[model samples]
Target chain A: MIKELLTKERIIIPLTGKTKEEILREFVDHAKELKLIDDSEQVYNRILELENIGSSALEKGIALPHIRDNIIRNIFVLIGISKSGVDFDSIDGELSTIIFFIGAQRNDKKYLPLLSKISQMCSYGETRESLLNAHNVDEVMGVISNWET
Target chain B: MILKGEKRILIPIFSEKDMLYLIKNIEKIDTEGKEFILLRLIDEQMTKNVCQRLRRDPEEYLSSIIDSAWNNLYYFQEELTKKEIHSKVSLKTGNALNELIDFGKKTKIKVILFSRLLDSGFEGIFKEKLLKNLLISWEETIIII
Candidate 1:
C-alpha cells in the first residue's frame, strides 16, 4: 500500500541541503512541481509547524516529517538522502541522513500505515545503510520494496 | 520543554492490551488537574534483534506492533476524552528505557507509571540494568509499575 505512494518521481537522491529548513523546502518544492499541492508556502509552513511539535528525528540517521492537511488531495512523499547528515535534534543526538517529507490529506486512511512503514523500515541498521548507499531513485525504491516483501 | 511547576505523569505503552490494563488501573486516580501522556515506542533498531534472532520479517513484525499501539491509543484517547480527562498521545522510535528517561526529564514528570506484565525472566539482567539506570536518572520521580 505504501509502495504506491513512493514512486521514483517523488524521490530525491543525495539531497543538497545543510539545514533542516533547506532540505524541507527542497522536498516541498518537488511536491509543488509534481502538482501535489496547491500552495507550497502553506504546505511548507504546515510541515514546519508539525515538526515544531517535536523533533521527528528517530535513531539511525532517519527522520520522518509528516503532516496532514485538507489542502492536498492525496499523500505526497519525498525521500531525500544526505551523506553529511543534518542536526535535527533527534532523540539519539545523531545527525539525520534520510529525511521523509510526507504530506497527507486529512481524509487519507493510509497515512498512519505509511508512518508505520517508515518507522519499521528505519529500525534496521542494514536498511539505513542501504538507503544511504542508494545511488538513484530505483535503488531507494528497491530498498523499500525489499522490506515490504 | 517542560513548564515551570507543571506536574505530569508518564506512561509508556507497548500494546493495546497493555494500555487497556493501564487505563483500567488509572481510572481510580483523581486526575483533577494533572496531565497524562501515553507514549508508544516504535524501536526500529529492535527489528534487527527480531530479524537476527527470530529470522522474521522485521517490517511486518514492527508494523503489527505499530498498528496495535495506535489502535490502543485511539481507544484509550476516546475513553479519556469522554471522561473529560486531559491527556495526550506520543509516538516515537527508539529504546523504551532511554526514551522514557529523556521524556520524563524533558516534561518534568512527577511520576512514571507502567502496566506490570509477566516477567520474561530471561532478560532479568538487562531489565535490572535498565531499571537501575532509569531510577538513578530520575531519583525524585516515583516509579509505579
Candidate 2:
C-alpha cells in the first residue's frame, strides 16, 4: 500500500532543509511540482497546523507528518532523507533524518493504516541504516522493495 | 462545578484480543454525544530487544504485530460508528505507560475504558504497576472492564 503512494519520483535524497518548517516546505513544494497537489501553500499551512497540535516526529530519526483533508484527492507520500538530521521535537529527543510527508483525502479509509505501515517500516534499525546509506533514488527504492519482500 | 459538554473517552488497546473484548462489551458504556479515541502504543525498546534476541529484523517483527493491531482497531472503529459513536484511531511507539498518560492528558480525555484482559500477563507486573500509577496520577475516571 505504501509502495503505491511512494514512487521514485516522490523520494528526495540528501534533503537540504535544516529545520522542520524548511523540510516540510520542501516536501510540499516538491509535491506541487510533481502535480500531486494543487496548492502548496494551503497544504503547507494545514500540515503546520497539525504539527502545532503535536509533533509528528517519532523516535529513532524518523518523522511521519501527515494530514487528511478534503483538498487531497488521493493518498500521497513524499519521502525526504537528510544526512544532517533536523530537530523536529521528537518524543525521544532525537533529530529526524527521514521524513515521510503524507497527504490523504479526508474520507480515505487507508489513511491511518498507511501511517501504521510506515511506522512499522521505520521501527527497524536496519531499515533506517539502509535508508541513510542510500546514495540515490534507486537505492532508496531498493531498500523499500527489499522491505516489501 | 458541574461540567456539561461533550466528554471524550480513551481506550488504550495493546492487542487484538483487547479490541475484541471492547467491541463485545461496548454496549455497556453510555455512548450519547461522546467522542472515543482508540490508541495503540508499540513499545520500541521491547520490540528492539525481542529482535536482538531472536535475530530477526525489527521491521518484520513489528510489521506483523502492527498490521494485526491496525485491522482490529479499524474493525472496532467501524463497530463504534455503527452505533453513532464518533472516534479517532491513534498508533504510537514509545514507553507504553508514559505515552498513554501523555496522550490522555494532551487530548483532555475525561474518561478511560481499560480492558482487564490487557492487565493480565505480557508484562503483567509492569501493567499492574501502570494501572496503579494511572489511578494515582490521572484525575480522569478509569473504568476497568
Candidate 3:
C-alpha cells in the first residue's frame, strides 16, 4: 500500500527546519508543487484543522499528519524522516523523527489498514533506525519499501 | 501485506493491551475485501464496584467529558484503505444502552460487539444501562466478542 503511494513523485529531500511549523511548511510547499493539494495555504489550514480536532502524533517517535479528501481518487502518502526530531504534539509528547503524511479520499476505505501497516513497520527498531539514517529521498523510499514487504 | 481497504474501524480502546490484541488480529486477517468498524471504549475513568441509586451513579459526573472525547475521536476521518474496520467508544451521556442505540442509529451500524474485560465494578451498572437504553431492534445483531 505504501509502496504504490510513496514514491519519488511525492517525496522531498533535505527539508531543513528546527521548528515544527518550519518543517510543516516545507511539506506544504512540496505538496503544492506536486499539485497534490490546491494550495499551500490550504495545506496550512488542513494542519490547523487537524490540530484543533486532535493530534495525529502517535506513540513512539512517529507522527502521522493525516487528512481526508473528497475529490481525490487515490491515497497520497509522503514520507519524511528528520534527523532532529520535531515536536508533533504527540499523546506521549515525544519529538517526532519519523513522519508519514497521509491524504486520502473520504470514500477510499482502504486507507486505515495501510496506515496500520505503516505504523507496524515503523514499530520495528531496525526499520525505524534505517529510516532515521536515510540520506536521500530514494533512500527513504527504499526504507519504506523494505518495511512494507 | 498491507491491509488495504477504504473504511477502517475507529475503536477508541481503553486498555493499551487490548488495542495491541486487536491490531494483531487485524494483521492475521486479510482486510482486502472488508471495511472496519472503528471502536472506542471510553477510558479516562474507572468503572468501580461502588454503586448506588440511579441519580447518584458515576455516569452523572462523567457523561459530558467522555462524550466530548468520543466526538473528538470521531473527527479523525483519515482513511488509508478502501475497506477497513471501524468502531467507537460508547457515549458519555444519557443511558449507556440508549447512547449506544442512538449512536448506532446515527452511524448506521448493524452490529455492536462487546466484551467481559471490564470489571462488573458498579454491580449491574452497565447491564442496567443497556437494558434501559438498548433499542429493541438491536437485539438481533449484538455480538459479544
TM-score per model (chain B): 0.75, 0.82, 0.44
* C-alpha lDDT of residue A47 in model 1: 74
Record all residue pairs in model 1 with backbone atoms less than 3 Å apart, i.e. clashing.
Answer: A123-B44
**Candidate 1 vs candidate 3, TM-score winner:** 1
Please provide, for model 2 over B8-52, each residue's C-alpha lDDT reduced to its tens digit, 9 standing for 90 to 100. Answer: 778888777778888888767676666677887677777787689
Per-residue lDDT of candidate 3, residues B75-125 (tens digit): 422321212332222223333444455555655555444432443444235
Candidate 3 per-residue lDDT over residues A17-63, each given as its tens digit: 66777767777677777788775686677675654344556556777
Candidate 3 regions with alpha-carbon error over 4 angstroms: A71-73, B1-145
lDDT of 1 by residue, B1-145 (tens): 2334544667776655567777777765556665567777555665567567878888777667676665565457546654656565666657867787777777666777666643354233334555677767777655454
What DockQ would you assign to candidate 1? 0.15
Q: State the lDDT at A77 in candidate 2.
A: 94
Winning model by lDDT: 2
> Candidates sorted by DockQ, descending order?
1, 2, 3
As for lDDT, the candidate ahead, 1 or 2, is 2
Give the Cα RMSD of candidate 3.
Answer: 16.0
- Model 2's A-chain: what TM-score? 0.97
Q: After superposition, how far is residue A27 of candidate 1 from its true place, in Å?
A: 1.1
Over A28-147, each residue of candidate 1 has an lDDT whose tens digit, in order, gives 888889988889999888777656544567666888777777977788678999989988766546799999888788768777667766766776789999999999989999998888
- CAPRI classification of candidate 3: incorrect
**lDDT of candidates 1 onward, in order:** 0.72, 0.79, 0.55
